[model samples]
Target: MIDPLQIDDILASGGALSKYFSSYEERGDQIEMSKLVLQGYEENMAEVIEAGTGIGKSFGYLVPAILHYEETREKTVVATSTITLQKQLVDKDLPTLMKALGKDIPFALLMGRSNYLCLRRYLDNTVSQSIFASDPTSEDGKLATWVRTTEDGILDELQALPRGVLKSDIASDFELCLGQKCPNFSRCFFFKSRKKAESAGIIVTNHHLLFLDAKKRCDNDEDYTEKALLPPYNRLIIDECHNMDKNATSLFTQVFSYYGFLWEYRKLVAVKHGANASNLITLAAGIVKGKENEALDVIKELESAEKIINNLNSILVMSLSGSEQRVDKSNYSFFLSKYSASLIAIKQSLDKITSLLNSIIGKTAFSDEDSYIQQGINSAICTFEGYSSFISEFLNIKEFKDKVYYLTREKNKNREEVQLKISPLEVSDILRESIFEKLDSVICLSATLKVDREFDFFRNQVGLDQREILSGCFESPFDYKKNLLLLIDNGKVLYKNNQESLYFDHAAEKIISAVRASGGGALVLFTSYKMLEYVSSKALSELAGFNILIQNGELSRSQLLKRFRDDKDSVLFATQSFWEGVDIPGDSLRLLILTKLPYPQVNEPLFKSRCEKLESEGESSFMMLSVPSMIMKLKQGLGRLIRSKDDKGVAYILDGRMNRSREYFLSQLPPCNCPDDFLDESLERRIEDFLY
Candidate 1:
């Protein structure tokens, strides 16, 4: 067992940490959290800690984790929600701790298998030309050069390649990976990363990969403790625990995209017409006793199936016409019922295609060449079966009564497509059985884990019963009252009854005034993409002097953020994702604007189902679920301001509903300077003073 005193000594004021980080201060919250984490590890119990920002949460957990592993030779896995935090731990925190401790600790980073390039696939596509015809002087040759010269066959390194080339042609296919039988398995980059992770003292990964690993273990009934993607470890740390529920739900969900099916169909067609097409036909002839008529009939049936699938796709697109808005399952029930005939037609077509593919496979012998064709056929068969099953289940609501089904429209390269998604009503049971029950110890930490100074909502959401797990909340070290100012609009025209245009105009005007008064360095966060676009279009001419960078605009996210930071007098408009995991310290960010309350859209299927479930259980869905969820999001958005003790800024809320929900909102937020007259000249002057 690790000594608690050793961990405490390291996090003390004059301890080893201060030697490397010159600005490090011994924070009480950090020390307390470290001690609790150490106790959790030593006692082999679950811990839920809400370590506020600036507590050095990473170090707080890292110190105990490294010490425990070094002393006991036990492996620990630290999972985070975003790549930014994962990189920070690997690139900054771990190295700093190693220096402070004066010892080398073995650690590795592991991602999903698709992130790495499979050498076998690359070789087959380029050299054997088994999948597609390739030209030596074209993009195929470029990939060959990259494969040879590159030491680590990770796809992220091949950024110079043309778009869609790597994803479509080179990336590893989960269904196609032959594992140990592959000729190039000895030099696989994904396996290398996995082997490193198996032996490393600490494995750092994101929550998605971690949940996926757990999902694999859950799916396999046998003992996966040794064969799981992640090495068997006793202790687990999940940072950004607020996102755990959503990530776990996503892991357990299934999605079928129209574009995805079309992409696969196109690939099948390409292979059928390629140079090797005759070889496959010959094999089919051999299976049918050289009956040329039968062989020709098989090919004809393939073409017929393709046409049927195409027609099915068109029918699906037509069903979604004029239904572009995101609709809850309850609201979409009538529409889907009205189009039951079309949905049933899709199912019938899928079943017909699967039957044809199966017949061809059954007739062919398992020769090497025939097996290659069989693999592709089997994949297509699975795709068709999956589509058929989904449609069947969707049409028969009784079969999926426990699941939340929803539909939404998405755009891919300016072409709109519909997506059908299904998620569990609650992932708590899954988490309880798959994660908490299997691990020896688990620590879940985040800055915004509590609402109204209680963790009951969060605890219930993440499947932690208060009787079983120890929980605590820590306030931030920074003085919010002294350093931050919160402003709420007191206007009478609150966002109500779908008056989006009026709200957008008012929000755009307020944003322009705030940005101008602050002299730029403003970050305006919107709740929806439509609102963001509306405001951006309206505010462009009004704020002509300042540089405005909109999210998903011409520039990428990283590029936009870089430009915003470099240009001091600039405003950035972003939605959803920008709410959290963004760190812009110092004067680069002077003002933060929230155009609306970050509430989950009532039309969203998952949100609607969760709310209904709560209501069924005799709970107030608004206070218990919606209010708490929104408060956490609000905290994340507000956290963008005042990253450090010396940093100062104003967090402005434009939602007029704050007037009625002021108590609930204010109680969850930090210190505020709410002027009686929100639009008065004095308020603008105060903002100017704060920025300058």
Candidate 2:
């Protein structure tokens, strides 16, 4: 086993990290956590850690991880929740660590295959492409030029193009890829990336891919395991570990969306002189005898399948009758009973289409001249099989009582349609069987994984066995009492049970006043889009003189944040995605207004089903699940207030429920000043004086 003292010395005040990072400050908490991670790996046990913000948690794990890899030459996989952090590790942290250590350690950044460009698809689109060649400035022309000069063929490398252009036109589609049989197989970007990852000592990836890999491993099929996306690894480290349950649940769940069906359908049917599945089928038929009849039959079956899908969708929309409430299953349980016959018909049509496509491919034996066309047919078959499998899961409701099934509406090119979706109520068993049991050692780390200084909530949610796993919590090095203030609303008038509009108006008034008192540098967070819209409209008109940036249709998250940071006196209004992963420090952000307590929307089918299952198991769903979950979210929001030692801010909770849940919420927060009457004129004046 590696010496714990050696690890500590490396992370000490005079260690390599401090020497490398000019702004780095040595913290005892970071060192302690590093030692614990090393100890866990040595003992071959799982570890759960909640390291507070500014704890330098990345280095704490990376140092130990690198040392372990070098000493044992074992592959260590690090999975993060968001692309922002994943890039940070690959582009910043790992490079800096390697530089400090002065060692040539091989590391690779692995993303989903869909993220890379497919050479075959790209060439097909640009081979003497006449679609937009007449105009050099057209989107298609520019895309064709980019395809020629690009090296890595990763979507992110092309910043000059629109987001979905590559995904739609050139990105690798698993169903369409010909693998080793393709002429471009020697230059495939996805395979090249996989090869690099296989040989690297450390692999960096996201939570979605890692969980998907685990799910495949749990199938216990040797063929599937051998052909798995990722190389073999026994040690794993998951950052933002709180999202693991949700990520795992999503991976295990299945859904068949209207847009997905339409996407596959468009690929097969020729549209506006474009090459499609039918043309490819005909091309293949010239090379193989009797294949023409089989191809024609498959095309006819697909056309019929498309008609049935459209008919079923029309019936579903008509039954809903533009009632938005029908989208939430908790509000409308009659959907299944009313449309059972149509659902069955749709399922049968899908099965028939899948069988027809499979049979066509099974009978074809084309020469090299038809290899490309054969690849397209194989791709269509794979898509059909996926559709059939998803439909089977949706129709077989009896197999999964803990699963929630629902229909939701979406718009595509001004046309509205409904989609069927399903999710597991709890993924504890899935995680245990798929991920935990297959790993020799696992480390779960996050900033908000603990509530009331306990890991029970996190452990239960993540399916971590207490007897086998070690857990710890580390406080932030920053002095929160000196730099932060948490305030709860004492004004009962804010929660008068008025109409939502009236309540929003009242909330808007408070928000405006707070932003004005702080002279801007405020982040107003809302729980829902409706509330955000109402508050944004009211505040925009009321606070006209201030620079207001709202997170909506106008700008992206990164763009909005950039504008917020550039202007010192700016108020940014945002919802869900802004609750966490936002970092604003110093005087640029002096106030944070939480419109309401962060609570799981009970109407959401997944949350409702999970609560019901917990109740059936003789558990207090509110205490065991709801409260802890909200507390963690509250902690995440609060952590956003004080990012550094010099940063000072005031966090205002506008909800009146904070009074009843004061003990539970406040105990999880930083130093707070809860006055008896914050709405009083004198109290308001006092708050202004204190904050300003």
Candidate 3:
């Protein structure tokens, strides 16, 4: 298929990249990675590669991808972990690639089904704004204009929904959409994007949507080849592959949030004062007059549902008396026995509500206009059915050799809540069967996919350990040793997870001093909110002269990042989410801090379940799961610094256990400077000296 491996002519000294840029430093690793990708496509198997920063791994895969598409005319779905990367590919990289290629390639970006505006739902909810926003000064007027003119009705284009509208009222939803039976079938934004994507050879999507395609194919095997979620694709490229397992676990995890479960009924029947505050079932009853008896029946069911939900949640909150617990089949049987009466009552209520709605739908099926109402009612039926089904499945856990059952608590202003959940102990086998094996070829590449210079941890975690696959590790071309310096606490912050008072004071003082010396451009990462809050309290008072932002503050992540990035002298203290995907490539981010090593919380139910499984298999769960996992995350934190060749930064690890795991740390990361001694008061001065 067009000689997929013949790439030297395009990537050599006078090749496409060199001619495209006036001062391009060709990276050999990039070419090598491109070859590895091409080999994967040629051989029709999985290829796992760990390419370091500055390797331009995107282009490495893109060049081969374009060649393969040209030869085979087979679609390739590229899945990324973050929306930031998806935007980068579609908005930035693709244009540059197009310019370099001297032509356009057929490509499209598709998000999950719920991201686009459901024209049917939007119109059904807001009639005027959905059609003619003639009052040009109004928000609805603007939205109407957007609705008429926008190519893809993605929520990303709009800043906010109307003041009274819920996202579900306007955006695409799984529970909604009657497919071709709807009046707006041809014009539906999600299906329009899907249809548009069918023409493109390359499609870009995020990990959730990618796995959703897999799950849909698995759950709907009779229609497996029908392009259920994504178009049929022969080859797949997964960037940010290190996050695959985490994302897969989240995708597979089933949860019934107690509050959310209660809110479904509230949305249906709760009436409150204010414009448009009357719930949907109330408004629907008014719209379709003459269904008074059925509407009354719906009301009675909702009242019963609310009481049962409160009792169910009360049972969980009172019985557990802890934040989390791992449950066995016996526990499931216990819960089933405890909640069986309440569960059956709620089911009866939900079933009654569903039946009434279905009856209304049956009577309102005259015209396409009338049918939108029926469709919305149908959607409500699905939601109620889904809620009932999930509760049933959660308590009805049976024969769970591959899954973990658990319960969790969330504290709020009014209620102590619990969430019942079931997560896969390991997503490796699930992913191997559901996604990788189904595809003709797969390329999983990331900057931090390996542990101790080997893909053993990642491969085994993703169920590719025994698969016939090609793997490689490509080091970054940048002079990390020259550009980035790593400083350890030497013994000042004696954090052995004990002597808590001593560790907090010393670590906080060190963090404050470093940020002060840097004059505010620092990202101090912590493993827990408790520590983040403790240090932020100390810093906010001590470092009052500088702009300081803390994680879980009043601002959103994007807002905090904007302030941190735009103001060159702002320090942002954040937790796990900020460790990666932070690309501040300038002098503003010359200092990074990690207060503690990131080890999985041993008490968390999912982590405990996985560790127990590993232990049962006669493996050292801490050595195999904990250490490698910590190292990968450590590498991610370090990679946040020196994102580009021009950027120079210093990172500090303030935990004493870091020295204990020195061997694993040294073997896992790239070559960087780590001066042995910093046990004294000169650490702050050293950071300033290095930066200035």
Candidate 4:
């Protein structure tokens, strides 16, 4: 084995860690972890490190992983939790590290097929166009118009457009996709992304795609299978490891929607006289009818709706032309009005179907008494709820309504096969064995994994055996007492027992007060939408003239973040998505307000199952499962602050649970002292002092 790289010598070189990175605390942690990871790789063990806020852990692991691979002539794969972070590694961190290290390291960004543009979509809408040339003025015409302006059909780029635009315009399943068999294969974006990954030495991918690749392997072991995404690599590093469990779970479960069915019906209705109209409707109706033991009339209504949608799609395709400038105005308006109406009709039908499905659930005892049946019904209910939302969005006067198309697939393996629409629930096992187990060395790093410094929660959730697990914690460089303050406010009135709304009001009051005191620079974090909406309204009203932005509102997360960073007097209140992968240097944000203890509700269906399994061992469900999960999330939230040495902030938790309900959860939070006088009135002065 190679001698371990000297941490002192590496730090003295002051490579990428010195340039573009202002936090010494962050740089120091990176160097240490880099050394530890190299050593761990040499010893053939799993490394888990908890690097607190302001620790530039990304570069720390990335630089070392790249350098080690170079020195040893081995390949490495890096995994992160978010696409945003994945981009940072691919576009920013790795580039800087390579430059500083003076080595040309190969790297690639890999993502799900959906994340990339659908070349078939572009070609169908562009070259031998279907949505436009036949009906310039139709809804498909607008999609063609949007497609002309877009380089590729990447849904994310159309953020300025309405909701369904991205989902409809960009989404193309492998089954629905014509693949290389399509006339548009010459310029397929998905294949291009895959090619990029195939050429790279170090690959960056999210948890979803990582698991998706594994799922693909399970589905088909043939050439160009999903395993193609995970080329040969010797080392693996998974940042934000806490999210792996949920990511894995989400990747393993499956669900389908009626809105998709309704969209198809609307499409058929739009394409009334097209060649495939009747044939498409018949197939669509067959798929809808095969779902479950629904009432005959309900099934017939759904089939009729599907036929109508099929007709619409066919007509819309015929009316459009390839040239975007040749859009038919009158036809477009006609299709929009009729499309909206048809969608509303289908939505109403779906609502009835949803109610029927819900009523069928629990009312009639299942003769089979099998878990799969219950899972199917539960999926149906979820799909119904999701489709209801989609119908509402589609019927509204939304710009995206015209640009999107929806389709439903009948996944029938055989006549006797129980056709269950599938979506994956977990990627952990696949990630563990395929990536982690396959690696010569591995490091799973995140601030939130070990609650109370115990790796048991993260270990079991991530599916890594305890014997191979090695762990450590790196302290933050910031002065915790002087720069950071944790408010152990158990006395904050929660109005009534389990009153979520009251808790929002209480939390909002504290946040608004903090904004006032700090001259408006705070990020109030919430756990859910209802809480975010309630508190955002209150905070907005009080913090007048200050840029008080609420997440899940009018703006996207990135847009809100830009607005927050652009103005020193702005405050951003957001959810778990904003917990990590955010960088704000200087004093733009100095106060972090948490509305409650960040616990995944044990009552949520997925968590309920995990909790049941844990309870079977005579363990406290909250301590073993919920508490660790939340603590990791909370650490991620707290991490947003003190991004660099020039930054300092205060974190305030309004929930009494942190102090009262369970010590195990509380102990997992970042170790910091409470303010001598942690009151609302003195909050601003405290923050100002911390920053200055």
Candidate 5:
């Protein structure tokens, strides 16, 4: 029976791992920050933790939450950005804390449904020959046979098999899940995981699932959805709080694909085969036509309309590609236009059907809600509810509608060859009310929270009210000045400062110079995938005898990390995913080259919307979305360099914006009392000097 004061003593004593891990200087400010966070959780108030480098932030907060959970027997939901931290907590950190405290609490890992194998999909492939055409006796089919005999249904277990044979061959979307009606429901791994999670005292999940649940709850009041799986809990602790807005935005946006539509259309045709074959086939043809596709069954007209849609989709993909500058040219504009038009037509068709259904609804003498009339109401409502809003948004972008067209690939059975439009934008207010407002307590914790020394930018974008915001800063346990050389070059060759080609070559050269100087333990980070690819292609043959790991160079994160660790002379060129969540302790990573400050693409649909909203409030969108996000990411990248006390490294900001920008990113960044001469332009040798 330990007392609260003793608990405080344990924290002060630095627990068991303290001796092995780096020591944190217990400053008054840091202690106060830790206290505030603990109090906030106790009082059920929203809190933001901006723990800077050297502040033992992870354990500082983890200790209190663990203590609270132990006392009350309540669950503490810890959400992290990467699988690595999730593994760390489950395997390392939590165990150390538990052993120190002599307490064993229940915990469970909750992940997306896709992470688990679909028993139904596996069973169907085994039982049905008509469903999948290839001979079951063949090599591929023989492998499927082996899977049925020895399938554990865990994603990690499945990975042991040949790569393409696993996820590539088998998957069942939730909509197609058939629930209890499915024969394999009793043996589904997803359900088994959910059952365990529902009962566990402490649940660990990623931010993606949390946001997915919140959005799914608002959109569909269904139990099998993301929100329904969440066990009733009083408090929520978001670990990678910086990514909340970006993840939430992605959750709310709906995207329709040409391949998906075509597949569904074919399925519908297949189901109504034989006597109905000719008419259905004709209707499907019309559905492929641009103007003819107005009605779901308008065969000739749909065929003509689909042609027009395909034409527009092609143009839009090309035009939008020019603006966003990512490799995958997902013609989002084409989808928006065609879907909007289709929605209008769908509504009209459904409206006519509704009139007929209403006439026969009660006349059929069906009283149950699932009856014909109720069924009519149920299905038709999905089409009519948001029809007007989608149409209005579409009409507003009428000018870009002309550019919408299809990008088709030749003989690609695996991929949806027909490129479709999608709306990639932020959905803040919706997420805030749906998830944040409903939760009793919301805790957003991260190493990088305060950008330019203020949480207002992140707080606003995440839809948290300023008055409700309670923030704290826990300084890290590492010595930043001694371990890190903060290098900010005032070079004119930056992405925003010059032509695309000019900046690429300039950035590539700088990266080469850093790699050569460091003898290669470096990570060249890029905001855009295109830039990463460009720099990678240029560096590939140029930086020979050095292991160059590029983002898209057929290497998984784990693979790249292994390669980098194996070779002292190696550099990893990475983009969005690698910008953060990378942990290279010691001298494995000695330098970080940030190609540009990460800012939300202005052309992205959600970005445009947020920008307008900010403009209405007389605030700069760049400050709200751009600067804060960049600062958090920059801090994350910087933190990756000096993972432990012994690790020494340099972080180079190639983009002059970090130096020129009016202290927005710097003020919010981790306070590193860098040497006065470190940022000197004349001290060209300083970077090399620090490396040694």
Candidate 6:
């Protein structure tokens, strides 16, 4: 249906793209990817493209996207996994493409509701504005004025925000928004973002917002094809497709914790130094015409909520309690009885509060100037009713068809928190029906999508296999084999069994040696924060000369990254978030060490449930579920080293578990020097040899 040569010529040298590049060399894999995208778009099916690093993956799909938009005048929604990627598109990628094409195509970035500030909430003096002085000369006044005049209403951009200002406190929330009924509706930030998407030719959004909007649009009875926050776009390009399952699961997951509830309680009604602070209860009472007591009755329901959760927390935390970490309908009867009773009581209280709010809303009418009071009251009602419905679903719990329910106690510094959680066992069907089935064409691409050198794992995991799919795994343009050496530890220090668990001490020595050899600028990836802490502690004293930064500490992730990048000789010890989205190329990052094979925790509620289900169906849960999932994670950890063609580094995996499927995982990576027999003592010298 489309001309392959047309896509190739546009990407080749001296073509339109040449104008946008400094050197202007062409990438074959990028062109091939463009063809796949164009074909997928014309044929109206899902396409999975695994473009390697430095292949210009964004431009691969973006070129065809811009062209398609120009020809058809139809929108294309580009979804990325994180805000950074979304910003990259809006700020960098699109501008280059638009320049090359010489077209002024309009595009907008839309984030979730909580990312933006709410003008109505910011103006509510009783609840939100009480902290700020009306004087424009005051510190709080300047902050308020800045918020009013800021270009984008994103709270993330506001650097001087006062402490205790929670995102939900002033951010645009679904329950808090009154839409056109509110006085500040004309200047509403959240909807203004959604409204900007209404006419744009291209809409850029992150995975969380994309999944949330998809779930919302699909859950409705009437068709919301042309409705909802997102504009009607038949085509979607989801980069970082590997994170689809995780994001979708998060969207479907529900959690209720005692501390989380307490925070909500304080937000609604709390006494600060015997003075009424910015809270919903006092605001509602003040708005009541003559029946202030009637309005304050909502606090009774809140008090009941607090009591029920406190009892539940106590029951779960008691030393003699029979409750296990995991909770379900099939669990201990005593735990179930107490848990259900607590949830039921909390739901009843929420319902009563909802009813009381309805009565107050009916009785309280405001002048046109004070319409925000009425709307704020209504928003509070929505918030309460939402929690009530959440509990209602948890009572029977959403059919429990493909869901995992669990209760766990987390120990904070001074207190223990009991939390109830529900997550989908699998999001395949949900995504298949909600996204793949509905969209005219869907394109899911990521560097680490193919685990063990096959797209089948990714396809099956994300419901892409259900339909006719076009897939390709384009090797990275960078020469991994020439640039990086893959070192595997299959020596005597490897884990003999799970319980012996003394591998970390040895791993720590290797990490210290490795960092010493490389002279710092190493990123050590661990399976958990505890392991990271252990490894860093073991190595910190020995490697005291090298500047070391560890995660879960004083510096934030961004701050840590900035410091690591600036100090090229510094080593960053982190887990999870640091594994990917880190793009330190050249001398700043020369060594990468993965301390262990990233396997799902045996105690993880959702993972354990998946394994049980697989076993119940007579499947090898270990082979079927765990190994492949880990390979993908391993691939991501490895992909960090060789970021660009000019960049060279040595990546070592300390975990011996990778040896079992070493060949399988190795085949997935670019042709590299994967040495089978490397001595532990000689690792430092070997890594030094490779780097120099």
Give the number of the best model, judged by lDDT.
Answer: 3
lDDT of 3 at 121: 59
Candidate 1, residues 596-680: lDDT per residue as tens digits?
9888777576887788888988999988888888999989999888788888888888887777867767887665565555563
In model 6, residue pairs whose N, Cα or C atoms come closer than 3 Å (at least 3 residues apart or on different chains), thus clashing, are: none
Best by TM-score: 6
**Model 5 off-target regions past 4 Å?**
1-6, 14-35, 53-58, 126-169, 178-183, 215-227, 262-312, 319-426, 492-498, 661-665, 673-684
Instruction: Estimate the TM-score for candidate 2.
Output: 0.90
- What is the lDDT for 443 in model 2? 95
Q: Model 4, 1-692: lDDT tens per residue?
A: 54545444445345334553565322556567767877777777788888766566776677666666677766677788887788778778788777766779788877776766665544432222443435646555655566566544445554453323345444554534555655656767666666766767688888887666655654564322224557655577888777787777666654323345554433322222333433223323334444344444445666765665555544444443321111123244664564566566656776776665554453434333222233344544566567667557434423321122222222221211111122222344555665455545678887666666677767776667534766788766666655666765555675344776666677777777767767767888877776788888877677778877777556878789888998877888788678777888767887888777777864453455456556876988877777677777777887787776656677777777565654555466555667545665666676666555
Worst 10 residues of 1 by lDDT: 125-134
Model 6 agreement with the true structure over 1-692: per-residue lDDT tens digits: 34667676679887788766778889988988898899888888789888888999998998888878887877899999877798899989899888877889888988888899888667653333545556666556766777768766887665444555555667786655667877778888887888888878899998887877777777874243576667877889999989999888988888777777775666566442225354555655666665578656777777877888888777767732322355555654655465677778888887887787777667656666545446555765776777777676667643444878777667643577667777889998878877888888899999888765668878877887879888897888888778989898865677545743488778887888899899998999988876788778877788988898989656768789889999999999999998789988989899999988888777677888888888999999888878888878877888888888899999998887667777777776678988777877789889888887
Could you give candidate 2's per-residue lDDT for residues 1-692 as a string of tens digits?
A: 79988766678878777787777677899899999999878998899999988998998998888999989988889999888888889889899889988877899889888888888777665432556744558766666676667666777665444334436667788777778888998989888889989888889998888887877777764322254777888889999998888778877776666667767766665422355423665555546656678768767866777777788777767765432322233433465566666667766776776665556556657666456566766777777677777776655555447667766666654577877777776788778777777687899999998776778888888788543888788888888776676677774655443567777876887888888888899999998887898889988898989999998756768889889988988999998788888888878888998988888876566776778778998999888778888888878887777888788888888887888867767778755565555553443565577676
Q: What is candidate 1's local distance difference test score?
A: 0.76
* Each prediction's TM-score versus the true structure: 0.89, 0.90, 0.90, 0.71, 0.75, 0.91
Q: What does candidate 3's lDDT look like per residue over 323-397, in tens digits? A: 788777557677677777877777777787888877654554345434434545666688888877876776566
Better of 3 and 4 by lDDT: 3
Off by over 4 Å in 1: 122-161, 164-168, 222-224, 271-337, 359-374, 672-680
The per-model lDDT (C-alpha) reads 0.76, 0.76, 0.79, 0.61, 0.61, 0.78
lDDT sort, best first: 3, 6, 2, 1, 4, 5
**Ten consecutive residues with minimal summed lDDT in candidate 2?**
322-331
